[model samples]
Target: MRCPSRARRTRALLSALIVSVFAVFCGGEIASAQQEPSAPQPVSAVQLQSAIAKLGDLDYSARTNASRLVRRTPAAQAVPALIQAVSEHGDGYVRYRALVLLSGFNDPRAKDSMRESLTSPNDRLRAVAYSFFEHNPDRALIPQFVTAFDTEQGEFVRPAVARALAAAAAGDGVEVAAARQALIRDVARGEDFFRSSVIEALGDYKAAFALDAITSVAKLDGPLQDDAALALGKIGDKRALETLAAIQRTASRQTQPSIAAAICLLGVNCSSHESYLVETLKFTDRNAGYQELLRAAATGLGALGVAGHQEAAASLFDVGIPATEDSTRAPVALAVATIALRSTRLMMTLLEQYADREKAVALLAEGFDMLEEDLDKERFFAVARRTYWESDGASPRRVLMQTLIGTLDF
Candidate 1:
């Protein structure tokens, strides 16, 4: 045991063992640092159940936080629990929140839950059901929606029903014509709130046939006036220009942004109107009244971005660049990303045209980060991913978009 050669051999082996252990530990750290993040572990059954239960928490912040946690659950794992909660949750509010969360998944499995909720006694649940169908329009549901629209007395629920009807009308299939007429009548009469909703849907669907009805609404002096004007512009019919311009001249400051946005959408005096929108966002005194006005202007810019206005994208960046607060910056970021995601070419061209391309990319990435719902963020991600793969691999725009999409963690 005391022999010199044995002692030397023992020391060498121990030293080698220590080196091997150190290498393994340090190498793992290095590999982890370089690797893409691992897929999140599935939430345990108990944890998921607890989170689902919290969906109905009395505290608003608590409920919101719980919602965020449940939404982050992988769709494959979350769908079953969500469907169950939506279907069998004892609490009405929990059932409503579960359905709302489930709708975000947009899974075919949740369709039955959503359909059943269409007749739910809870007005909020009924509203969410109508909203789900608004995006996932089924011509088959048109007759049922028509009946609901006639009978739905809940103010909030009726507007959603109106939107669903408008969506069904946009689809190419049976009963579309009937859906269209129902939607028009909905705007022409019905409660102001319901009519406002139908007007919005017409604008969203670009129902040029509803132009006469929307124009009449635009001429009226009230809340629907702005909604109808915006709808007219979305229809892209130059015929509405005279009406929009006339409204702008007499519209109050609060209503002016909506009118200006409509005029810009029609490509008439866009520069002036665009400048006006930018000016609206530039106000330093953000009191409650100013905040309301700012939100309105932000919404206008979002509409413009959706319409693929490159200049408006630049303007969004211009407004977003200096904003420090997340609340202040979120709308601007969302507007910028909305424009960029419209098309790969538009994104590239818009960024290249911006004063600072680096900041443009950063802002777009930030916009992706600000998407509230995981499903919404996923949609934008899918669009960005599709555009990236479709473009020439060697194109600079492709490279730029790839970089931008890479920055999106959602």
Candidate 2:
């Protein structure tokens, strides 16, 4: 399709741009080490906020971390600029960062913009808007979000509304029973897509009203099973443990990984089925579930915080690589690698070349275990690893791996 061709050219252009810009822009990295400043820069808080508000175009010339400096200025000023970017920007990356910056702020206007974005005809724009609204409460807009779900023609945008409404239902407590009933009705009739989004929206909600409903939905046929299973994992209540354990017992090896991950996250600590991950790793299903188990294993390993944890994650990472036949395996490996390398520089390199959706895709975890501290590092390594793994025999990752092995040997 014409769209694919355009995206290929854009990615090629962007990759070239990243390499050329890195030396000129990123050579001076931000040091996390605390230091007492000798003198302050000339920019005042007011002036800085003004500059952030006035900048009409995306500063593509700035380093990859430019958005952080912009965010640190002031939310009152930054929110308006970000709202404008969502309304007008041409570049998806720029719009994405602006929204990321907006996520930290608590301006009332942002809620309106977010509401509008939820209903935006543009799918990508709607995605950006929902990303910000996900965190930080915006309760009054639940009705708006719910309406968008049934009326909107944009396939991508409708899900965001469902999620936003679901989050609102969890946070705002407005007509919660009615909302629960509506979602339950949909689930009963086999509206798996809407039901999944609704369950996902109810993350961390321990209310008795929803728990029984979610559990019952999990028992249903079709994809809602996975959705309910994932939601139960997010709730992290002990009540779901037995259900998850049963699910893990009966689930195909492919489905078991997700069930395990859900259980690990939602089940009571490392107590319930902690060994579920370890027991399953020995099998090789090669579907998305195989990757899910690796991810769940990495999470469990990270949580276990023992020598064996690292060993288990590393071994799983090795098996996951060499890229499985199904392209979905790439993101699966990336997530597992992320869990395996949490808090280490190993993850920093993995996220660099990460791209989403079009053509060859790479998946990443934005909030997986304190990734923000070393976000650029994660991006750099992601790019470096994927580029190395995908190219001919000679590439950055292979050469780097060789150097690392030699050093370890020495």
Candidate 3:
């Protein structure tokens, strides 16, 4: 299901927010991607096999160097070897790494290995398979996903299953429709963690069918209510405005920022909600533990900016360009960077129409600055390149995306 244009603005914003928030609070990788460096030259098949074997080497450096060689090998040679390693490697880590590299190839031959890996004894492999299906949705595999939904119990793996099912539900077919209903059922009655997973994926995919169910969950003053409200916003149906407004008035202070964001996303009474997010971000009492609130506000503003909220982008530039603290600046920079990268046409229009070009570019640079690791920058730009190629050839966004790539490569 395609989101209304407004909801599409939040697409990449949501992904970036999740990555930034997790890194800030949980100390996790920011925007993780199973990316590899550009290939140098083709290696002999024997040499490639040796490198693949070293993927499971006991020495960390050996494994690391082996990954580089394997990744840099041309896909014609690397893909088949990776597929073979995924199937027959003695070490589970080697198998997992092989599958990850295979995903980058975008070759159809890797599908069987990906499908079989779903049943692997390794939890990590199963998680990777679910992620693979999420990106490569196959109607033929809907039954397999349904089975995984029923039986998969790994904490991390289950969410991947939910994401895959939600993505598959985006297709047109009776089986897909059934899969959609089952997903809503899971959201309604699944255990706490699982429900959260399903709800998030539904929102991420902008599944319109789950609106009423998500709205009902929003009305209840339960733990899932916030997630439900966010999903409703992402679904982008204005009909949920009344439900969102009601919850906003009575929700706890900590949750209001998210509700406000959801309300803004619907493009109704957005200015007030945007103001509320700014106030929440500028809240001064740091010792009282309001960092979560700040992150929420930053994420919300990022969504607004990406959605073509010129005012929201202005606010981010003002607050983020000069900010120093990681807790405060990192999320803001991410918001600004997303606006520049994901909504290139809109961002370019804003910069041209307004006078914030230099400052906005500076803030955009700050976003990259936050990505200290070379791997993280590579993943971020890799995503940018994919998005650029995927966009319409004649679109202004495509042109601006190319400009962004050159401007930000430093």
lDDT of 3 at 67: 68
Candidate 3, position 275, lDDT? 94
Candidate 2, 292: how far from true, in Å?
Answer: 6.7
Residue 371 lDDT, candidate 3, scale 0-100: 33
Q: What is candidate 3's local distance difference test score? A: 0.70
How many backbone clashes does every candidate have?
Answer: 0, 16, 0
User: Per-residue lDDT tens digits of candidate 1, residues 56-120?
Assistant: 99864467556656765788888899999987889998988788777666579878887898988
TM-score, model 2 to reference: 0.54
Off by over 4 Å in 1: 1-37, 58-69, 72-74, 171-174, 249-253, 283-296, 310-317, 320-410
Candidate lDDT scores, in order, read: 0.68, 0.46, 0.70
RMSD of each: 17.3, 11.9, 7.5
Per-residue alpha-carbon lDDT of candidate 2 for residues 1-410, written as tens digits (9 for 90 to 100)? 00001122223234434433553686733223222111222446565544444333444333322443454445555566667876677665555455545544556776666656665555655765654454443666555555565566654455455545555566335565445555555545434555555665564343345677788866654455665776676666668888887876776544554566566565354444446655554343344445444434433433332212343344334444444442323333333433433333433243223231111112222112122212222233333333434545665445543332222110
Candidate 1: residue pairs that collide: none
TM-score of each: 0.68, 0.54, 0.71
For candidate 3, the 10 contiguous residues with the lowest summed lDDT are 1-10
Cα deviation at 94, candidate 3, in Å, is 1.5
> Which wins on lDDT, candidate 1 or candidate 3?
3
